[model samples]
Target: AQTVTQSQPEMSVQEAETVTLSCTYDTSESDYYLFWYKQPPSRQMILVIRQEAYKQQNATENRFSVNFQKAAKSFSLKISDSQLGDAAMYFCACRSGSARQLTFGSGTQLTVLP
Candidate 1:
């Protein structure tokens, strides 16, 4: 079984600043994918970043990066140069290599303060 947890229910960051959202997962499967998704007011799930269980290097996409700690089952997302457009509901998700379904966290609403 695999599960994802986001400790913070909400987060706020100043515009043009940075924010880090925390996430943790528990999975018995050795092969899996950890992901951070952002859902805006339109309710579209956009992939922010992803990390493969077997990959030793963390994943980074532009201003979005992840700090993945396999041993501790931690996958945190760092958003640099935050903008108003970045405000959304962020979710941490996990999927086993063999599974088609993704388990997601409750989500953390990000507020970008101008």
Candidate 2:
């Protein structure tokens, strides 16, 4: 079974500071996709960024970027210029092309301090 792992239970960052959340996964298949999702108090899962296994380049979206290590099955998220609005629960998700179902990590709670 493929699974995502989030080592950090909680993380804090000052306003305008940058922070990176660690994540890892266990998968035997070579074809897969990694995703980072942000769940605010509303519980809406918003996609932060995503990386394709076949792609060597890491994915970046505005202030968010990912360090995707395919061999290690590690996909870490980096948030630059963090703001108070960035406070939320971040989750790591993976899906293989075969199953086409998402396997999500427990999650990492982020608190952006003022």
Best lDDT goes to which candidate? Answer: 1
What does candidate 2's lDDT look like per residue over 17-103, in tens digits?
999999999988888989999999887889999899999999999999999987777899999999999999999999987987999
Give TM-scores for every candidate, taking all chains together and pairing residue i with residue i.
0.97, 0.97
Model 2: CA > 4 A from native: none
- Candidate 1, residue 82: lDDT: 97
lDDT of 1 by residue, 44-109 (tens): 889989899999998989999999988899999999999999999999999999999999999999
Local error of candidate 1 at residue 33 (angstroms): 0.3
In angstroms, how far off is 36's CA in candidate 2? 0.1
| Residue 43, candidate 2: alpha-carbon lDDT | 70
Root-mean-square deviation per candidate: 0.7, 0.8
Score each candidate by Cα lDDT: 0.95, 0.94
TM-score of 2: 0.97
